[model samples]
Target: MARSSAGPAVAGLTAGALAIVGFLAFQASATAPDHPTQARGDSHSSAPGNGGKKKSPSSTKVPADSGTGRRVVYQLESRRVWLVGADERTIRTYPVAPSSVDPDPGAYAVTSRNMSLVGSDGVQVEHVIVFHQEDGIVFGFSAALDGSLPNPKARKKTGAVRQTRPDGKALWDFALIDTKVVVVR
Candidate 1:
């Protein structure tokens, strides 16, 4: 689903993350919150834990315009990344592109922000997790593992469509805002 450019617009581009919370929840069996298949726009054509070659995003991917404001955080092992978001009791995750490190991953903080990726060992890791919250909410799609209908812009698509990787240069990317707060030890 695509965020309506006609409604109230938010600011800046958010990052695309492979939120684990959501994925685990969706993929979970009857005892868990079955993937709200139609809730948010799933962004892939495969299922989680499948294929094993690519990580699927169980969370939604859209532009954020929630005036609710965002909290900030960072990845544990991979530092130097600004995981911009708010604190929540339940975190919804997606299968984002795994990040590498420079000798060791750098440190990140909500207070400290960095927009550039730190390429290490010939591999550039994730720098900033830009959330396109708008698109996520508007379309009610979580960039799910199979949400590629409404918007043909998602980076995940079929070879028939000849989908190219969207660098997301635009200032809008959806994301999972609310989640269980992890107290890094």
Candidate 2:
């Protein structure tokens, strides 16, 4: 009688495969940035100024009319976006390249997200957070993979508010589906 060698060979191969997977997983985790899951105010005013009145773009404050509690605030005219915390504090704010088409100043919610996709403007975009749509136009936030903004001269009516990669990731973490998005003038 001869003993089959298949059992030991399969076991050895499986172990080796699992070892490789574990090593790759470790490397990915080790290199990933330690970004906080929750947006935190950078010692900025926790409350909206002027008795909850809207602040000017020159002022480094979140718009007062952006509603209460945690939300993503998008100011169309200023080309800025603010990540607000639960206490109505401005956690983070940064400039964005507005798309040719604009959404009306109002409230919206994060309706869908795509980690990576070819945007309507034909750019490779990531961390897409779509919030609003009207008259067949869709509004969303994304960061281009090549860090390029849509051409200002192009006549395309894309609604992708372009952001830097880091900002996109931060927004991705903070604004899950159903997250409130307040757009102000």
Candidate 3:
């Protein structure tokens, strides 16, 4: 009687395959979001995580003249940013720390993005979304790794609009490359 070697080979292959699949599954779960339900834009919905409730009285409204359709509205005067969905509803709006060198009030698109980098101010920042560049100054939005705001007293010409870590994540998720960005006074 000849012993079949194919059985041991097949079992080994199966074990290796299962190990790879288990590892992949673990990796996916580790990076997955805690909340499984993603928010979709609709006329009745009031931003993600709101559960379709109306915006609170304290929440700032998107400017009337911030341009229509999906766009990021940066209010230079108010130092705020509004992420407007295609439905013209404000998905998220939050305050930002303006940079010393402000970009001209105009329309632009997100040119590039970096996950992490050392900011010009010598601070570690993340979620950098570059939109406009003028002269030699690069304008973008980022959040400090330490959750610190930009130093207004710094004399360097940097156009880094700083936001909180959570806000940075939201903006990172909303504004992608080529997304319209409108700057208004």
Candidate 4:
């Protein structure tokens, strides 16, 4: 009787340990930085002559009318954002998955920023740059710590523009309070 009871106790402890380990692994992967290609899941191979070095998406040309000066340009039509330097050059540009409700094409400023938060969509996000709000809906840019961009609920109004983890860090560093944000159609 004693041996049988001990067997069940040991099994319970082992299962509990396994559960804890799995949870920790999930946390680690969720916070890891994402490679650019992983954002779009593009598997295109590099040029045969390039020695197998993959080209980064950052090398792509900036969109037209991204605006001049050190500013954050949110291109609604392209669903992209560009961080332009004061010298009128693009410091970085990346694709973002915007919400269904977009701020009107105009100039705005970074009103607030948060280092980390649980977004309205229930995702863990970092580097949140809030620029605009309308009709009780707050609009901003953020990236999920897990590098995932789940589709927003159709019935909910969300203005969070999701980027990759790296891009989110860059945006957080570049966009300060009162930083100009140009929204172009």
Candidate 5:
């Protein structure tokens, strides 16, 4: 009787341990950033912005060799944007909250800009920079004046790359009509 009881207890412990391990694995994958957008070995640092707030730092070099002139580089996988100056130097680099709908990796030009307006998603936005459009959905960069980064609605089609208010201001000042915007994987 003792031997039979010990066998069942051992089996139970093994099953419990397996379950725990499986749960942990699931959590790890879920927390990991979507693999398609993982940074490609680029070094990043955290630096303070003009407002004394910590800003996401990016490497001085562009994420990819998309072109040779001044442009805005948006790394889809890293979810970072770099404002490259005329001399091929990075003017500023910061993090952005990208939409589920990603623009293809290529070069685009800024078609328009708005100082303030209501986004298609109905959010009050400022410094809207229009870069591309697909089907009927327009894609651009904008920031909420209130400094909020709300989650996109599951059923809404949105392609707004969101930044902090200060970052938005910087982008607005930098990206002008016909400014080259490079989208990179």
Candidate 6:
């Protein structure tokens, strides 16, 4: 009888712990500039003085194309994209069109979005794609599409598909959009 009573209590405690850790992790990320932009913050920038909040850079580094100097391209996550140069430290951030997903929203890369739109030909307003990761760290784009989440089709590019994490449980998953890693320069 005691064992049965303890099961739910233990589960509840675990859930509570996970939630706390997730939230703290999320807070650290939301306050910082780098953590994959999985969550949104009201602050302009944690970078003191500038007060300018830049978009998060993609985990995948797109190499420069020839003497292009610096070519700005799109990321699969619309909300956050890139400004890649010979120097990785020189990346920049900008806004993206809000995702068509409901309950929560996301971003996409401009390059892939344009292509998908052209191919879409007004067929539909959204696209579907999948991202794979383990231990909450995203590896890269995946060939699979996950439509089971609250959003039927997610177009956010960066950190689109998030797994349960220690901090705030915040995750970004790319659902509705098709993406590829290519040098658009």
Top candidate on TM-score is 3
TM-score of each: 0.22, 0.69, 0.70, 0.67, 0.67, 0.28
Q: What are the RMSD figures for all models against the true structure?
A: 18.2, 13.8, 14.4, 8.7, 13.2, 13.2
Give lDDT tens digits, candidate 2, residues 112-180. Answer: 999999998887899999999887778999988766675545687778898878789989998999999
Q: Candidates ranked by TM-score, best first?
A: 3, 2, 5, 4, 6, 1
Mind sharing the TM-score for model 1? 0.22
Model 3 clashing residue pairs (backbone): none
In model 5, which regions exceed 4 Å deviation? 1-60, 150-153
> What is the model-wide C-alpha lDDT for candidate 1?
0.24
What value of lDDT does candidate 2 attain over all alpha carbons? 0.76
lDDT of 5 by residue, 128-165 (tens): 99999988878899987645453555477788888767
Which lDDT values do the candidates have, in the order given?
0.24, 0.76, 0.77, 0.73, 0.72, 0.31
Clashing pairs in 5: 37-77
Residue-wise C-alpha lDDT for candidate 3, range 148-174, written one tens digit per residue: 556566788889998767668888999
Give lDDT: candidate 3, residue 140. Answer: 97
The window of 10 residues in a row where model 1 has the poorest summed lDDT is: 161-170
What is candidate 6's lDDT per residue for 64-112, written digit by digit as tens? 3312333333343432333444444434333222223311222222222
**Where's the lowest-lDDT run of ten residues in candidate 5?**
30-39
